[model samples]
Target: MSIATISTFVTAALVLVGIALALLVGTVGVAAYQFFSQNRRVRVARREPLVGYYRTLAFG
Candidate 1:
């Protein structure tokens, strides 16, 4: 292949790889955020110190 064709192919490959990496990272970040938020909410919902009582059971 010519130099121009090789260069174009390399450039396209790099761009696609970069985009794929960005998407994967973004998806992971969002999933992590959601998990933490849900954990926080559950903690808040079940914050009562009393054990074996209705509040603890409700939180769980």
Candidate 2:
């Protein structure tokens, strides 16, 4: 094949690989954010009960 043809093929392949990598990273980032946010919400929900119990014990 000619040099120009080879160069075009290589460039196209690199662009496709870069796009795939970017999508994978974006997906992983979104999943991680969702996992952490859900964990934080659960922790916060559980804390309210513990705080109320501590207050009752301290006052009464």
The candidate 1 region of ten consecutive residues with least summed lDDT is 48-57
- Collision count for each candidate, in order: 0, 0
Global Cα RMSD, each model: 7.3, 10.2
TM-score of each: 0.67, 0.68
TM-score of candidate 1 against the unseen true structure: 0.67
lDDT per model vs. reference: 0.77, 0.79
**Cα lDDT of model 2 by residue, 1-60, tens digit:** 999999999999999999999999999999988876666665576665645644664696
- Name the lDDT of candidate 1: 0.77
Best candidate, TM-score: 2
Clashing pairs in 2: none
